[model samples]
Target: MSDPNTADCDSNLHASYYADGMQQVETELVENEQIAQSTYRLRVAAPTIAARAVPGQFVMIRLAGVNAPLIGRALAIYDIVNNDQGDPTWVDLVYLQKGAFTTPCSQSPVGTPVSLWGPLGNGFDPRPCDRLIMAVGGIGQTPMLLLGREANGAQAFGRPNGWAKDVELIYGARNEGLLAGVDDFRQAGFDVQLCTDDGSAGQQALVPAILEQRLQEIGDTASVRVVTCGPEIMMEKVAECCQKHHVDCQVSMETPMACGIGICFSCVAKVKQADGNWDYKRTCVEGPIFDAGKIDWS
Candidate 1:
């Protein structure tokens, strides 16, 4: 497969890839509403960034002039909202307010000046498949919505048409209050399946077990593909289940990042080479999205 990070991060809104020349803009926060328990959906006016963003991509954001936390926080590009003229105007990000950056960010009033950069990292591959299963846990569902929209023909990103015959989301959270955007996924035509650890949502089972059951029901492994994000342990289990069923799987790594660009090695992930040796690859540039089989999950 070709390197997904080589695409131009310019004004080519419909391009299949984006990279290197990502824009850093001084934009103002439009809205920051709490969508779920401790989860806030932040909207920022970043036309240039939003115009080039694809599903599974992320942005580094910080409150302009805030020095207590000097480094920007990496947040997934959840969705893009267009204006009446059909021009991409703002980008939305959903985040759990648990950390230093996020807690303060959530408290910032609307219209606060925000500085953000991106359309960074390699996004999920929009290739066609018979069935696309999104295995998610915690706040991992943030990036899956746009992917689902593209896959179900409701929106277009890199490709012009919907690529999957069907899309199902197996989302798991601690409880019902943490299950953000379930209705949004359903609205986008995904077969929504829910699971929670505390039995406060759809099923009491884990996400990987639910994924395994779905894989078994599908039977035809070649036609199925799985993409997972969330806790590493959960993703590891999802990857294992996909491998056991001979199904192709992709993972969106949530490695801690300092810079959205590849200059900092802070977001490196272990990737397996063809020669059987594993090397560190920068998640910011090489991927946030990687083939599950190529990852050295150890």
Candidate 2:
């Protein structure tokens, strides 16, 4: 009963939109340092991916010339740096060593060659707003860092003033030891607030609770936008808080993806449509970043 034209439009909108300069390239490992327990900060010389990458997009990585894993693992593009000529030259990946693939990846030598393809998936669209608040938990810090980097660039999101005022980061982790990259965020000029469940860090509370308190303090909820990435329950609670406060919010979902491209539907999330129906969306293409209110958390 759908209009053919409308259906075609929807298909095109949801289809994989590849940016220019996307390609499979052999990236040399520039730095692979253990930042925390079972966590690593990996840097690669991937000019192509870095040049096109935006906040919330991801890259697929695999050992060069190895087929044992068969499929590459998708990782969020953590950060990007440009050279003196303003050409992107480096990309960073901050990941937890949890699985077989990542464990081996953590031990990869600095000079090892790896296959990478990216800047894939839709990224966060930071609209012109008065304030931006990012709430993250544990390894969810990945995409948030890139967002911070963009905000620090001053001209990011085509905004003139940049994210100058009322930009805050509410980061929650299990403990102090697990709080990675706090210094980096602080150095980027964000009003960083740290939370820990064990009371071993800054504030003793969960991220959502902190976010709710911060929103209340802000008072002008209409002028604020909350962007979050973390545990599903935590994000769900964040969505609830945003809804109650009448604030706009976006979420970067974490889902297992076999192929970073849209060819595989392995990474799917239930999204609510305007027609009041729920449909499965490929997180690798249609998202990783989506309007928090549009997701059916149940």
Candidate 3:
């Protein structure tokens, strides 16, 4: 039995749309010491998507057909940006160079025509909370940008939710060089924590370590509700840490997707349902955002 109301909410509140594949006319390389990741901010040139796209979502990208034919690449919606010409010009599909396909796609210089379809996946539920903590690991921090935007969204010209006083972000990378875009979030007024594994810059530890340290600094474990996205180990560690401290946590899980839609179960994740039975949820549809406790990372 399905609840008609919930189904309506999913249809109305959580809707999906197709964004046309556009050429990457521009590529800005964000280089740091630990990793050399290039970001390709695709110019969608389509106004419809720009107006409706939400945060914590992703797009399926088809690499330029150069040599061999391959399936499309799915990239997180790093930013929910607007077009240059203003109101309706389009959206930007930012890609973090991470794999073989991404590597070639990275080399394809500006003006390379590629296929893209998205604004896919279920994003975070950005309702009001007493306080919010966002934690990111590696390139996984990309989606945090959108979460920041959502937190700062206005229904018209004023803060719709009237979000409360505290907002924090914990970011991780190998060295100072790998910690790119920390400044952007900071400029947006997030209490940003930078951590590295090699003691290069910021805090000398992993993100989970810094997060725990921060929680200790605050000393109020129960007030923090976390939103996290990162490596499996980092998320698991963070989740465990929060639980140990009695903090409520929400995590964004990233799994490989075949269709970038519900048709393919490749991106399915095990979730503990209300009935106490575990069910598999497609990350493309059911969620990328879920309560940390409901997930059995084991």
Candidate 4:
């Protein structure tokens, strides 16, 4: 058998090969993410996503229009759940169609084939944690979905008392209409809280406002930790909230990129290394994820 990693091996190979590797040749377009804005949800045909993807991992994509002017765009894997046949896990990539690549890709039919190249970079570290607090804003909620799914899984984050407790996904958007993945999150048994700016949904303010109320309601505990991913400014505010309350927090940061690897300095973000040297780390490789305190987000 030939590896799907290599696109196709033998010129003489049978037509049924690609069909037999249906798991490797399938794709999805504009489902969950699009519900938020002009977003698109893609199911990539990669073993890398199914076999190896962990929480907060990302993938590189090249739509016809994006590469010529800029380069391939990188998007986080929102979720990695099994498709209907249950043989392969379809990766969830949630992206807005504002840019050149995404705008074109969004126009393609649902079954259109697109080139995908991930489960790239180091994902979140595995732990036996039973409680999870996730904060999200704008389209940044994409990565947290995968994180939430892992925590919701029966083995890694299941309750010892046989009842789920303290797994909350707090989101902030413009309105209830702008909220994506509401059902996906709710179906996973996550406590969902939405704060809309227009007072159209859950609460009317920023994510920090709702999160503050949550912490006030639950009080502090060593077992309580936060994982945040969003715009740079929003993440900075979240860091402040965690710091004031002394809750451990990790944040995923976004930077402009032309290459989704370390060779180009485009995706560099400032972080302090072990030796105390302040340096720039590649977001494409070192992380789209990092310790919130490690960087000067200002």
Query: Which one wins on TM-score?
Result: 1
Give the clashing pairs for model 4.
none
**What's the lDDT for all of these models?**
0.86, 0.80, 0.65, 0.66
Q: What are the clashing pairs of model 2?
A: none
For candidate 4, the per-residue lDDT at 229 reads 81
* Candidate maximizing lDDT: 1
- Which run of 10 residues does model 1 get worst, by summed lDDT? 8-17
Better candidate by TM-score, 1 or 2? 1
Candidate 4 on 30-102: residue-level lDDT in tens? 3433556676676655644565655666777675333453576788877666658854456668787787787
- Candidate 2 lDDT by residue in tens digits, 258-289: 88777768988888877777778888777888
Extract clashing residue pairs from model 3.
Answer: 21-116, 25-111, 33-177
User: lDDT of candidate 1?
Assistant: 0.86
Error (Å) of candidate 4 at residue 163 is: 13
Tell me how far the alpha carbon of residue 88 in candidate 4 is from the true structure, in angstroms, after superposition: 2.9
- The predictions' CA RMSDs to the true structure, in order, are 4.6, 3.5, 5.3, 9.2
- Candidate 4 Cα deviation (angstroms), residue 239: 0.8
lDDT: worst 10-residue window of model 3:
25-34
Tens digits of per-residue lDDT for model 1, 181-230:
88889988899999999998899999999998988888777988899999
> What's each prediction's TM-score?
0.93, 0.91, 0.81, 0.81
